[model samples]
Each structure stands twice: as C-alpha cells, then as structure tokens.
Target: MTINKYPIIIISLILLSLNLQAAENYKKFDLPLDLINYMEISLEGKTAVMTVFAGDSSQSFRMESLEDNRSYHEISYQGSVVLNNEGFMSSGAGYPFDLIDKTDVVFDNKKTRILFYQKDPESDVKFRSRKKNNISIFNDINIAGGDFIRGSVVSFWADIVINGEVNEDVIAVYGDISVGQQAVIRGDVISIDGKVDIAKGATVYGRVQASGGKKKFQFDRWTRWHNKEKDFSTIIRFYYDRVDGATPLLGVQFTDEDSLLPNVEIYSGYAFSSEEWRYYVGLEQSFWLKHPITLGGSFYRKLATQDDWLMQRNDNTVFALLATEDYRDYYEAEGGYIFGRFTPLSYFNVEIGTLVEKYTWLDAHTDLWSMFGGSKAFGSNFGSVPAAERASGIEALDGAEMASIILKSDLDNSDREARFGQSFWMGTAELEWLPDGWNDDFDFTRYFVRAGRFQSLNEYSGFYIKAGYGGSDGLLPLHRRYFLGGLETLLGYRHKEYSGQEFWLGNVEYRLTFPKTDITGLLLYNAGQISEEAGKLGDAEVKQSIGIGVSFEESLRLDLSRRLDRSDSSFQIYVRLGINF
Candidate 1:
C-alpha cells in the first residue's frame, strides 16, 4: 500500500486537470451593486471601467483590479489621484481630472466607492477613451429630484425613470420607460424595445406604447430629434400560411404612437389554386387615452366563398379559408362596413355596426362546367379555386344592407410561460340584423356565441376546450346560415360539409411538450351539429373526428385525423406550414 501512494498522487493530479479544462469555457463576472446604479461598468481584458454622468459633465474611472465584488480605488497613472474620504479613483493616465469637481457625480463627499484599481499595463487607463470602455447614445445628464423637462426628452440606448413631470414627449429607444404614479407626461410615452408601465393613477395626457418584435435587436434610426419623431410606424410581414392555401402573403400595418389605438392594415394575395385575387383594407380606432370608444371600418373587393355563413364570410373563419388552395365555389362581395365598440372594462365590450354590400354568386352552370374541361373546381375564368367547399350553393343574395351588434368577453394569459403553461377564457356573441329596404327582399337576424378556455398543467402539459352555437331567424338566406366542419370545427370532416341556419360545435385538445424543447404532441377531438331551426339543434346529426399530431418549433404542423362515425373512414392528411393546434 505504501508503494502505491506515489501512483495514486499522479492519478489525482490528472483528474484535477480534466476538471479545470471542462469548467474554463465560461467567463465569470462580479461587481458591486452600489457601483452600477450611477455608472455603467464594462470589462476590458481583466479590468473594469466605471463611467458616471453628472449634471452636464461625464467622467470615467478605471477599475484596474478587483477582489471579489468589492471596489478598492487605486490610481494607476502619473497624475492619477484618489479622493480619500470619497474613495474615488481617476486612473485615466494623463487626462486632467479635478477630484473635487467630479465628486458631484455621486453627491457623496466621503467614503471610497470604486472597488479596486491597479496599473493595467495591458492598456493605458489614462489615455483610453471611454468610447471602447462603454457605449452610450445620449449626452448623459441626471436631473435632480422634482426636475421638470420642458421639452421632449429623447435618449437612445438609455433607461429613464420619471418621478417629475415631463411637459412633452418622453421617448426612450432601446431602453425601458418607467412612469411613476406621481409623474405626468403631457405627451406621448414610447419605448421602442422595452416595457412601459404607467402607475395606476399616473396620468398620461397622450398615448402609451410598449411593444416590439420578437427580436429585440430590431432598431430604427429614422429620427434624430424626439419632437420630430413620427407618432406612427409601419411594419411589413411576409409569411406562408395555411389559409392562403400555402401561398405566401405580404401584410402591412400602420400603428399610431400608442399601440392600443388607431391602426390600419392592408393585405392582398393571389391564390395558387384559386387563381384569384384576395384583398382586405381595415382601419381601427380604439382604446383612446381617455376614452373606451372604438371605431372601425373596412372595404373589401375579393372572392368571398360562402361557408354556410354570412352574405360573405369575413368572420374569424376567413382565416380557415385562406389556407386552402382551391375552392369549389365562391361569391363576390365588394362593399364596406363600419362599426363602433364600447368597452366598459377589461372583461367585456360591445360593438355595433352596419354593412352595405353588393353580392354576385358564382354557380356551377351546365355551360360553365362543360366549357372549363368539365372540372367543377375550375372557375369560368380558368382561375384556381380556393381549396374549400360547401354542402349546397345558395341562390344569389339580393344584396342588402345589414346592421350588426356584438358583445364580447376575452381573458387570455397565453403568455405566462410562452406556451403550454397559461390560462385563457373568451366569450363572444354577435347579432346581425338585415333590415328591410335597400332594394332587397332579404330581411333576417343572425346571432351566435362562442367561448373557449385553456388550462395549463405543469410545465409540459395543457388542456383546451371550446364550444360555439349559432342561430338565424326570419328569412335567413342559405349563405347567411352556419356551417360545421374544417379545422375551426370538425377537423376530420370536409370543409362546409354540414350547413344549416343553426349549428353547435365543440373541441377539446390535450397538449404535451417535450422537456427543454419546442417539440409538442397533441390529442384532438372535434364534434358538431347543424340544423335548420334552433329547436332542432339538439337533435341534429353529430359529426365527430379524432386526431393526433406533433409540431416542431411551430413552423410545421402535421396531423392524422379520422371520422369517428364512418366505418369506411380512413385517416385524412392535413399538413400546414404554420402551426394551429
């Protein structure tokens, strides 16, 4: 045993070497918290520099050496100096610094503050400009308490906290904006890539905005002066979606200073299969700084296929049709609609509006089919049809005016953990009244309500449930009725397979996410019933489907679904470029 002691020592040394090699890949940093509040710290080799902003002047201090997170100020230059009672060191070699005058930066006249300083021969601390030592886009200045900024306060790459009044706009780019309750901003409050929180009683004379793209690095250097800065911004997004029938779409939005209100969007696309034009222009004015009224309007000139609903289909299901490549039938509606919203609280809102439209029905006439190679999917114009369907085509609508009213309650927290760990509740009811006149004989009333919720189960699992019911009264035309099937309702059934003046649908899904990855699996079930009358809704034949699928990074969606009631039913193929479940 004694003879083996030497061999054991050598083996222990080798094990320690391996452990060191594995742990040196990451760099460690430690600095005192008190030093960070006033000055920005940066690392230069093994040294750190603290740059502080005073009333109208700026100064830099070199931290040559550090022991733990404590700062020991030691001047490392010829003219280097240290404030004894203040514990401050100026080591920018050869740079003239007045110790007494710079002491105003921190206000404290006593006590050494900087952690440590040594002669950093690796670089001369004296002649080194703070540019490389730190980066700031503002002419640094700190206002005393109760300070009032009379003009627009603009700073880039800087965080601002407002305790006093800012008579004009306060714009902080690439930084966060904190508005204390006692603080008043007579103008807009905007933060490009950071959060903006206004205290409960804080009064913002203008709009407040706090939003950015997923990539926080997205920056715009369009304006140099805060006052000249435009209160509006434009964003363009390009993506391929299922609703577009695998077509890539170019969408653009114009948002005002406050992200919550007054916006415009315009979208248009050419269908690959439908071979037609689809376009939409929408405008909204909602959630004003001091008011809850919301005004909106839109004008659309596109091929709108009847999906067992609407004189045209412009509801949420419009998205479902866009993923389609070919549509068996469609109608044209070119007109405008105007609506106003009144929200009393975060939980509920009411909207009332009017729509005036002229409709044109595209039917499969005998000549139309024969002339087009006898393909029902081919339009008379040889254009690709939308990959959508309906049970039976309706007689051409008489083209009338209608009034619509809606009440909604939406409570969503899907952002809690970014995915399967959140809760949501949403309920909405819409009523459309087709009044007599407008040179049309169609007069009807249509109404519906939908609600859904998601319950987060731990970090890897989630449960979702949704239900809906729709009904129509009076001379409700076929196109204004409801339909069930497709992704929004019955996934395993064909689009618009069931149509009626009234309908009910429900969906449930269980989601499980793989640990430490974006991979997710889903178990989905869908069922729905449709009827001509509300009384018959309960007895309507039920169409059901069950499905299983997996998604990766939400970029690709693949699913296998089968009809539950059909003996000959086989798994259906549903592939979406964009994830929906």
Candidate 2:
C-alpha cells in the first residue's frame, strides 16, 4: 500500500469530482410515506442515497454493497452499519423504501449529516459518539429532507416555533412577522418598513414604535412659544390616576400648505383639578384665502365635578364648585371665530372677527338658571340711596323694573364696543382728552372731559381718577371702575383680592431682566378704591409685593412673591406652564 499511495490518491480525487457533478444534475423524488418518517435522503444523477435510523435497538438494517469506489466489498449487519472514513454507495434515482425499518443510521457528506431516529435527538448526540472532532463546522450546514439544489442559498420561511422564552431583544427591520396565537414578546419592538401581526392571545410587554415617512406640520405658536416642533408632533402618554383610573393623553396635528389649510390639536390630563374626574377636548383649523388674508376658528370644552360652591367677593362675586365625594357637576363650553387680517403698513397689522360662544352646566340638584352679574353690572345703582338703604330697597323694584334696568344697562354695555354704541345711541358723543406728552416732563398729569352727565379725569395718566354729577338717579356703577391686580396692573397681588367701584386706582412697577439668563425681577405698587357714588372716595386699599423668578426655556415660569401688607405674609408661588399672553 505504501508503494502505490500516489495511484490511490489520484483515483479518489477523480471519484470525488464525479460525485459532485452527479449531485448537480440530481432529480427530486416523492415517496408515498410521510416526509418525516425517513431520516434523510438525497439524489445524485441516476442514484438516490438515503439514511434510515430508529430509536429501538431491536430494529436494524444493513448496506450490503457498501465499499470504496476502488474495492468490491460486502457487509451484513444485525445491529448497525458503520461507514469507514472513505466509503461510497450508489442506487437507482428514486425514493428509497428498503431502509425504512432500520434501527439507527447516519448519512453524511462531510458538510452535513442526517441522523435517523423515531424521536427527536439532542443536538450533540452525533458528536457524543465521535471523539476529538470539532463540531462547529457541521453547525454551519443544515440537513434538507426535500429536494434542494446544490450550491444555492437555503432560506427557512416557515413559522418559527419557540417553545420557551427569549430573554433578549428581537428586531425586524424589513420583514413581516406573523406571530402565533401562543407567542409572547417581552421586549420593545421597533418596526421600520415592516409590520407585526400579533395573534389573538399574544401579548407585548414593552412599547411598540411604528413610524413612516409621512410629512406633518403643526402651527401651535400660541401655546408653545419656545418649542415650535411641539406644535407639529404627535405624542401619546399613559398615566395612572388615583380615582378616575388610568388614561392616555394624546396630541395630534396636520397641515397642508398647498391647500392653505392647517389643523390644531389638544390633549387629555388631570392638571386642572385633583378631586373629581376631568377631561378636555379642543380643535382648531385655519386657512388662507388670499395672500394677505387668513381665516381661523377654534372650539374647546371641559368637564368636571365638585361638591361645594367656593365664593370670592370683590367688585363682583365668583362662585366655583369644589369637588367633594357626594356632589357631582359638569360644564361644557364651545366657541369659534372667523377672522381676517390685513397689514396696511409694514410695521402695523390689524385683525377683526366675529365671535360666538355658548356654555351649558349640568349637575344633581343645582340651579342652572341662576343669574350671574357681569363686569358692566357691578357698578350700576338703580337710585341715589345709601349702601344700607339700597340693600333693603330690593322690595321697591318689581320684576318688570329690574328687567328694564338690566336690559338698559347690563346687557347693553358689558363689552367696550357695546358701551360706546350705547353712548352714541343716547345722543351723546365721546371726546378724546389726551394730555400732550403727559409723562415726558412729570410723573403726574391731569386730563378731564364731560359726556352728558359723566366726567372723567386721570392723574399722571397711570391713575384713572373720575368724578361725575348731573343725573337725578345718582352714579351708575358702570362708571365707578377700579383695579386690584392683573397682568396689566398689579403684578404683585392676586387678581381675586382686588376690588373697588370708585376713585383712585393706580399701579407702578419696576421691571428688569438679565441678558445672560431667563430671570426677571419686579417691584410693584397697587392701590384702589370703592364707593357708592362717583364723587365720593371709597375705602382705600394699598398692596405692594416684590418677587424674582426665572422662565424655563421661555415656555414655563415660576415666581415667588412676599406681600408688603403683613409681617407674617406667606410667599405666594405661581407656576405658569404656558405663555401668559
């Protein structure tokens, strides 16, 4: 054998190449038996090779003609037939039925091996019987039971069954996933250019993110002064509440410039109250007809409930229902406007529109028809009676008289334009009394004018001082105006605490802002008066406070104030989440 090793090696190389060429032209075969029964089979040209195996030791088969291509050999087996390192066998091309009842067998082509058995064998079963061999090379190969072309990539497309749990992330970027009914995914899922279809009983433990290249633009300049993208993005937030249960806050917007159309959005939250269940819905839309003109409108509604009515009295009285366990209430409000804007000058713009509003309230055992006085009716007195006499004089005015008074005064002049219209309708003309450069020379100046029985004056332009005489009915409460605190007036005190109907109401503020940071400082002074008549000086109330705070990214603000009126005054804290204007 040593003297002729070269001849034997040359013959083996020729036979190996012939077998590979034969496999290239192999034809597939379909047998009547179940495809899962036989261990493995493959075809090569006119020859079909198969390996049969069984789990029972009593069952066995043999390959009697198995031999190397250079030798004529025969073997008989009562248990198993073990192929030598170099062995070959050939048979007619077709499904092999002769080896179906074999006990155990293996057919290998170096790259992959098919082990036949009646039950699933462990992955390392074949290697356990062999010794000192690297098994990783065989793992790169797969056993194919059906006809598969040699040298072609094999892709498994059937449904994957994972009996246990997968503890790590699973990502699919461009493929479709059809989850089985019993499947469960316990991690986050991110899909791009693909879709995941979860069956009826499937569950996903983490969030699912799905996105596409869809263009969206939102113009929410009014609410989001600092973050322009927030107006255009869609967001969903899940939150758990104490009483009303868990809920999701959603925001969405869309816009189309070619069509000159845009849409507004809203969200759901319990920030408005902590006691009762609450919800809000809002929407707005706008469009441009011409280049210079635009039209828009919006609608919003809020609903809540509370138990007791909280009252605050100043020049007017406000009643708010506070939430309690036994009481429930709801409110709905909706309004819209159609507006047109015109820019007559480069630096100046004007906008005008008509607004319509409707509000409704519902509750258990509540007076929905109760009358509420407005700003215009707060100062109106029916006659010249002292405060004590006027309080008891309600019996003198009948229903018709009260109705006449309300219709003539309150309903007609609550709005600034309406008041001016009423004055013009009564054959009266308003005069403009602007003191030339009132604040240029002195901090204080005076201006006065008369319209019928009404007279008005201003000291230092900032302080509106008024006195009137003429009508026998005495002073109409509408003319007696004063301020407590507001955005434009007292920045130091709460707007609810300020009240007056006559005399002096003035505010002075020194404001400074740091150029390097968002901090703003303010020192303010506020004063006001209330009276039964226009000429009489009412009670004098003065309020002053100092505060400093910072605006967060120009979107939110927090301010703290110390009241100057009292020694033990608690610091008033305010949080504004959005723009004040």
Off by over 4 Å in 1: 1-228, 231-254, 259-283, 305-324, 327-329, 344-348, 363-394, 398-413, 416-419, 436-439, 577-581
TM-score of 1: 0.51
Q: Tens-digit lDDT track for model 2 on 1-581?
A: 01233443465456445444543543221121211343443322223334543333222223322222112222223322322112212231222222222211122332122222221222112212212111111012222223221111111111222222322222332233354444344433333234545454443433344222331122232322221122266757543212222334576665432223355555655422222333344333432211223345454433322111111111011111111111112233344445443322222233433433333332222211113312211111222234554443333221111000000010111112112111111111111111223222111111111121111111111111122212212222211123234332344555424433343344443334454554444444444443444445534444565565555544555666666777977766654443321
TM-score against truth, every candidate: 0.51, 0.28
In Å, residue 414's CA in model 1 sits off its true spot by 3.0
Residue-level lDDT of model 1, residues 322-401, one tens digit each, is: 43233234456777888766544334555566676676554432222122233333223112222232322233353533
Top lDDT model: 1
> What TM-score should be assigned to candidate 2?
0.28
